[model samples]
Every structure is written in C-alpha cells, then in structure tokens.
Target: MTSTDSRTKEDVSSRTKKVPPPMYKVILHNDDYTTMEFVVEILVNVFGKSLEKATQMMLNIHNKGKEICGIYPRQIAETKVETVHNLASNKGFPLKSTMEKE
Candidate 1:
C-alpha cells in the first residue's frame, strides 16, 4: 500500500480501539450503631446481592469493620456511596460508604 494509505489505516485502527473507563470499588464501613440487618438490606437492595451473600458481607463488615461491596465506574461508585449515605441518614443510622480506585 502507499505510505498515505498505510498511515490512514493506522489512524483508523487507533481511532477504533476503545479504552475502558477507570473503575472504583465501593466500600461499606462498619460502625457501632449501624445494625447488621440494615447492612444486609443495603447489600441486597442497593448492590443486588443475594440474601446469603448479603449476610456473609454483613458478617464480614461486623467482624472486620469494612468490606468492598462492588466495583463500578467512577460515576456509579460515587452514586452508590451517595445513595448509601442518603439511605443511612434518612433512617438515622451512621453507616458510611466510600469509593476507591480499583
């Protein structure tokens, strides 16, 4: 192929390659006042965990003081943290959630 054609093909190939977005892990922190039942509920409802898995995670949080709930894109991680906080606050619990690069 001509040099111009080769360069155009390279350019098109590069343009077609997509890079995945950076991911973040959403973590739930344990606290004295946040009930285990509530934590399990959040895991099941917000993170879409099954009852058995939610209970396991809840136990992990209770015993270890924290657990990573899920991995998501930055906006989704931020939204999950905010949503957990809002729900906890509305119910007068002190459960906290945070996001970290994955």
Candidate 2:
C-alpha cells in the first residue's frame, strides 16, 4: 500500500476515541410549605430511592435546606429537575429542584 493510504488508516483509528458525557447533580431545595412526607415521596417516586433511603433524604432536606438527590448525565439531570418542578407545582407545593455540573 502507498504511504498516503497507510497514513489514512492510522488517522482513522486515532479519531475513534469516545468521549464520555459530563455528569450533573440533581438537587432538591427545601421550603416550609412542602411537607416532609411529600419530599420522601418525591425521592422514592422520582429518584427511585428506597423508602428507607427516601426518608433519610427527606430528613436531610428538612435540616439542610437543600441536598443532592441524584447524579446523572446532563440531559437526564435536566429532565429530572423539570419533572420534579412540574410535579411539585401540580401538587401546590413550592418544592424546587435544580441541576448543576458535577
């Protein structure tokens, strides 16, 4: 094979590197109007936390004012935050969620 053809093959392999998606943190913000039980429910339903773990998360929010609920890729984290906000608004609670780069 010609030198140019060999160079082309080598270049193709060098370009094949895969980049991993950046991660993000989904966070919950506490509010007095939102009940502790509701926060636990959100953790269980939205983040797929177990009941026991959900309860612990709820307690954290209660005492900490805010806490990281889950870590996900950027798109997933954004979708999760939007879902939480919509669910909270529909239930008439001032529950807040946000995502930050991890």
Candidate 3:
C-alpha cells in the first residue's frame, strides 16, 4: 500500500473521535401569580423530580426568583422550556422558563 493510503486511514481514524454534545440549563422564573404548588408540580411532571426534591426546588425558585430545573442537551432543553410555557399558559398562569448554554 502507498504511504498516502496509510495517511488517509490515519486521518479517518482521527476524525472518528467522539465529542459530547453541548449542554444547556433549563431555568424556571418565579412570578407573583404562579403558585408554589404548581411550580413543584411542574418540577415533578416535567423534569421528573421526586416530590421532595421538587418541593425543595420550588422553595428555591420562590426565594431566589429563579432556579435551574435541569441540565440537558440543546434540543431537549428547548423542548422542555416550550413545554413549561405551554402548560402554564393552559392553566392560566404566567409562569416562564428559559434555557442557556452551560
């Protein structure tokens, strides 16, 4: 085999290196009209947090005015934010969520 063929094989192997996808954080913002219980429910239903953990997060969101609910890849995080907005809107709450690269 020619040296060029060996170099081509090496290049292909090098290009096969796996890289992890960029992660994003999904955050919930507190609002005066949104109830604490609903925030906890969203945590439990959307982020799959346990009841206890969701309660704790709800407290943080209440006290701090915002909190990160979960870390996920870009598309998943985006979908999660959209879900939160839709759910809140359906329930007549002004709750909001956003995503940021992490």
**Each candidate: what lDDT?**
0.96, 0.92, 0.95
- The best-first sequence of candidates by lDDT reads 1, 3, 2
Query: For model 3, what is the alpha-carbon lDDT of residue 24?
Result: 100
Order the numbered candidates by TM-score, best leading: 1, 3, 2
For model 1, what is the error of residue 44's alpha carbon versus the real structure, in angstroms, after optimal superposition?
Answer: 0.6
Each prediction's TM-score versus the true structure: 0.90, 0.86, 0.89
Specify the highest-TM-score model's number: 1
Per residue, candidate 2 scores C-alpha lDDT tens digits across 1-102 of: 577556776687778967889999999998989988889989999999999999998898889889999999998999999999899999999999999998
Error of 1 at 29 (Å): 0.4
Model 2 CA deviation exceeding 4 Å by range: 1-14
Task: Mark the regions of model 3 whose C-alpha exceeds 4 Å error after superposition.
Answer: 1-5, 8-13
Candidate 3 lDDT (Cα, 0 to 1): 0.95
